[model samples]
Target: MVTKEVRLQSTVAGLTADGRVHTLSVWFILALRLMMGLAFFQSGLDKVLSGEFGAGGYLTGAVPDSGSPAADLFVAMGNTPWFVDFVNVAVPWGELLIGLGLLFGAFTRLAAFWGAFMMLLFYLGNWDVAHGYINGDFAYMLVFLSVAAFGAGRILGLDTYIEGYEIDGQPLVERYPWTRYILG
Candidate 1:
C-alpha cells in the first residue's frame, strides 16, 4: 500500500538515523583492525615457514631444551609420534587460516573467537607449566577474548555490515540474554 515516493523517503530517513550511531572513526578502526590482524597473520605465517606444522613437536623437546615446565608433558606427548605428527600438520595450518581471516577482516567475529580460543589453549599450556601465578600468558589470552567479547570487527570490518543487517532485519540474535554480554 506504500507509494514508491514514500518508500524512498522512509529509506532516506532510516539511513540518516542510522548514520548517527555509525559515526565510528574509520581511521581508528582500520588501525586497530590492521594491527591486530597483522600480528595474528605474521604468527601464522612464521609457524608454517618454520615447519612447526602442528606446534606439538615444537612444544615437546623445543621447550624442555629451554628448561620449560611442560617438558614432561611435551616429551611424553612427543613420544606418541603419531599425535605429534598430526598436530604438526593441523595446528600450524589452523593458525594460518585464523591469521588470514583476521588480516582480511573476512569473518572478524569468528576469527576473533578462534584467536581467543588459541590464546586460551596457549595460556592453559603455559599455566600447566607455571603452576599458576601472574603471567603474560593469561593476560594475552584475555586480550584476545576481550576482542571477541566486544565484536571488534564491528568497528571497521565485515562485522559492521553483518551487525547492521542483523540490527535491521532480525534483532533476535542480538536480543538473546547472553549475546549482549558476549558479543557486546
Candidate 2:
C-alpha cells in the first residue's frame, strides 16, 4: 500500500551528501582509524627495528630556535643521555600500544584520548608558528578527537561487543557503568 508521496519522501531523505543518515554511521571513521593506527604502528616499528636509531638527533632537532617557548626545555633535554634513552623507549612503546588499541578497537576512547594528548604534546613541542602556525600534528590531534567524539569504535570494533558485554548476574555495563565513558 505504498503511495507515490511516501516513495518520494523515502528517496528524498534517504541520504545526504555528508552521509548524516544516522549517528551510528561510521563507515568513514573506520577507514580513518585504520589509517591513523597503521601510521603510528609503522613509525614505532621502524624505530624499534632501526639499530642505529637514536633519539639524540631527533630531540636535538625538535628544539626550536629563540622564538619558541619550549626552546629551553628541548635544549636542556637534547644532549642528555638519560632523557634521550627514556624518550627512545617510551615513544616506541606508547606508539605501538596506542596504535594497536586503536586498530583493534580495544579501549578505543582511552586510546584516542591518549593519542590526542600525545599529538597535543607533539604540537606544542614542535610549535613553529614562525613559519605558518600550521602543523600536521595538530591536524592529527583533531582527527583523534573527532574519532573519539563520534564513538568510531562501535562501527567495526571490539567496543561494539564490549559496550553490550554482560556478566554472570548483571551486565558489565550495569556493574561498571563508567565503562560507557571509557570503552566507547
Candidate 3:
C-alpha cells in the first residue's frame, strides 16, 4: 500500500500557510457531511411534521434573554410580522433542502454554504460567554465550510456525476466555471 497526501497552501495578510492532508482522512470528511445531513434532516422533518416550529418566541424572548450581541437584530426580525411569516416557512424548508442536498451530495457546496450561515446565526443567537466564545454552533459552521472547501461531494456523491456531465462536448465545470461555486 502507498500513502497519499494532499498538499494545501494559502496566503492571507501576506502570511503563507501550507499543510498536507492524508488521503485516508476522506472518510472523516464524508462522515462530517453525513452527520450534519442526518441531524439537520431529522430536526427539519420533526419541525415540519409538527407544524409548530415558530421562531418568534425564541428570536425575541430567548435571544434577548441570552444576552447575545445581536439580540436587538433578532428581536427586530421576530417583531416584524412579515419577516416572522417568512422565517416560519424558511427555517424548516431550508433545513430540509439543505439536509437533502448534503445527504445526497447534490449541490453540496450550496448546501454547505447555507448550513454554515445558519450555524453562524445559531451561534450568535445562543451566545454564552461563560465558557468562552467558541461553541458547538461555531464549530459546526467551520465543519460546513470545510466540507465545501474539501469538495466532499465529489467522493461517492452525485456532484461528481453532475460535474462530469457533458455540455457542448465539454465537462460541466469546464463549460460553466461559475458552477464551481455551488457544485463540487
Among the numbered candidates, top lDDT falls to 3
Candidate 3 structure quality by residue, lDDT tens digits, 1-184: 8776678999999999999887778899999999998888988898899999999999999999999999999999999999999999989988998899999998999999999999999999998889999899999999999999989898778999999999989999999999999988
The reply for model 3, stretches above 4 Å from the true place, is: 1-4
- Return the TM-score for each candidate structure: 0.57, 0.75, 0.96
Off by over 4 Å in 1: 1-33, 49-57, 62-76, 124-132, 163-184
In terms of TM-score, which candidate is stronger, 1 or 2? 2
| lDDT by candidate, in order shown | 0.59, 0.75, 0.93
Task: Show model 2 residue runs off by greater than 4 Å.
Answer: 1-25, 76-83
- Model 2 steric clash pairs: none
- Writing each residue's lDDT as its tens digit, candidate 2 over 1-184 gives 5433211122346663332243334577887787778888887777777745566765567556435676677767877889888877878877888788789887788888888988887777777776676779889998888778767778789888887877886767788988877686
What's the CA error at residue 7 for candidate 1, in Å? 34
- Report the poorest 10 consecutive residues by lDDT, candidate 1: 2-11
Candidate 3 clash pair list: none
**Largest TM-score belongs to which candidate?**
3
RMSD of each: 11.2, 7.3, 1.1
Worst 10 residues of 2 by lDDT: 3-12
Better of 2 and 3 by lDDT: 3
lDDT-based ranking, best first?
Answer: 3, 2, 1
